[model samples]
Target: MKKLIINADDFGYSAGVNYGIIEAHKEGVLTSTTMMANMPGFEQALNLHEQYPDLGIGIHLALTTGKPVLSNLKTIIDVDGNFRNQAYYKGSFIIDEQEIYDEWKAQIEKILATGIKPTHVDTHHHANLFGDFNAIYLKLADEYHLPVRNNFTNTDSNRRTTDGFIYTMETVIQSSETLEKVFEEYNSVELMCHPAFIDKFLLNHSSYTYPRTEELELLTHPRIKTLFSNHKTIELTTFESI
Candidate 1:
């Protein structure tokens, strides 16, 4: 009874990404997606959400890109008055976890303001999983009673459905044997995926490129859909139902 939650990250990153995600969901195996609250294409993402009501929407809690939802942050910003990339946070000593909580809560509130309650939560660059901010993530999830995505790998012994995720790009790799191995390895697992059309924003502002298109292709693959549709062994589900 293995369950696969195929979640597309960065839904609100841009219009191209939003279209790609919708395509992945409508024509493929994407069961869930997480959106950036402060991103430019947020409204477009919401429009897609309206068009496809069943696509599970979650918060891609941001601390790495775009402007903060709360104004005038004392810490967690580089000298350029913007949040630093994931690399800086990995070694940061001056950041305030409370600020992270406040900012993240505001991001969630923005989504709620649109009357679109999120189904679950995860973070950009996995900010919550790496440092003191993990406490903030737990606080929000517990307070809201929402599912939080943990970075679980296939090799972990206690790989429950909610434990984390196995990535298609990193693990599946366009290989049928590798795809089969995932079903063999875990009873229930969530797959974290990033699928986009690789717009200028992603090219100029982010380190990630190329693999996004590849992941989208892999997610929409006919074999992958057939595997999930077979239904007896693997079920594709959202975290809310898991």
Candidate 2:
């Protein structure tokens, strides 16, 4: 069977984001989402989770967009103390691997403390796959026994992951014929998405702003829901099942 895990990233980024994700799961093909433990809408996301217990939640380990869950990070943060943006990681910035490990561990523990069993793990801006960060990402997954979203960089036979990972935003807005080709291509795939209602917080913080609303519309569209239900070979699944 061809399995597809449509996972909305940044579940706890803001109220708009939280609501968008919930709507996607409730009315569309979205089967799972990864929550940002340190994001502003974290508490709201937790409360929403209480109402929708079937939506599989995972830790969206972050280091680029928000403040660190653990304080006094020596390398990951900038002079102003907020975590540095994605550009810093792309450049020759030096970071302490141990700090990344400790901070991410705290993020996982924080979500666990809320009594939400995460289905798997992934990173914001794919930061965890950078240099030594991938090792720490895998380390935490092994310790917690959680499957990870495959970036094709951190492959291990023992680690649980979908056979393929698709990050293209264009595919999401394409026709149903295009989407069907995706399911036919991979035995199991993890499609990364960020669907939101486009609030002030999201508008101010994220560079990828308006596209979120576009994604939300496409995700919850009646046509997309029908595609999932009509396709016998395609199975909408969660990371927990992988």
Candidate 3:
């Protein structure tokens, strides 16, 4: 039988986001989540993790769209103290790899210090794989001996092309043949996804907010479940389970 590991991202983004992740875990097939240490409600997410010890928790490395955990802001921070935004804005900025690595190590240490042995590590906005940043990310994961979400999920292509009204309604579903090929080629894989409902708050506050909501729906879709039945066959193991 194939096993499945459903993950919810952005654990500490907000109260609403936290609530949504918990709900998805309780009612949906959510098996894991990535925590944003710098988010406003990070403490709340950590608290929730304490209550649900079984919930696979990992660090959501945020170098692109939020505040940095380390004080060496020169490496990750812009003119402001906040992390550089990669989700909505685009610009050619130099990444101080050493400072970035130091900050990431500090963040991982902070998460581990919280007493929750992180199952794995992933990044917000997929910044870990962005440009030269991936080297630092891979190095950290290797040092920790933790699995990372390295493979792409079809949900990435399920964005809304028409009017912004419809979400995953335009999901260009991928072929199972292709999905299988990818899994076979990659061996251990981490299909990352952000499955959530895009409410008024999300719409007003988030960037690529619509696509994210669509991503959530696609992840939970019955068709996706059926297609990836027994996701373990594709090496869909949790970050730490590996």
Best by lDDT: 2
Task: Give the alpha carbon lDDT tens digit for every residue of 189-224 in model 1.
Answer: 678888888888888887887888877787788887
* Candidate scoring better on TM-score of 1 and 2: 2
| Model 3 lDDT, residue 240, Cα | 57
Q: Would you estimate the TM-scores of all the predictions?
A: 0.89, 0.95, 0.73
lDDT, model 3, position 31: 74
- The TM-score-based order of candidates, best leading, equals 2, 1, 3
RMSD of each: 3.1, 1.5, 7.6
Q: Per-residue CA lDDT of candidate 3, range 60-124, in tens?
A: 88877667887756756778888876742355666667887888888888888888888878787
Q: Which whole-number lDDT from 0 to 100 does residue 213 have in model 2?
A: 84
Task: Give, for candidate 1, the lowest lDDT window spanning 10 residues.
Answer: 152-161
The candidates, ranked best first by lDDT, are 2, 1, 3
* Best prediction by TM-score: 2
Model 3's TM-score against the true structure: 0.73
Q: Candidate 1's error at 169, in angstroms?
A: 4.3
Q: Write the per-residue lDDT of candidate 2 for residues 1-242, one digit (tens) a residue.
A: 77888899999999999999999888877889999999999999999999999888999999998898999698998888788888887768777888999999999999999999899999999987676788888889999999999995644677799888998845743666776777666688888899888899998999998888888888888877786788777788899789
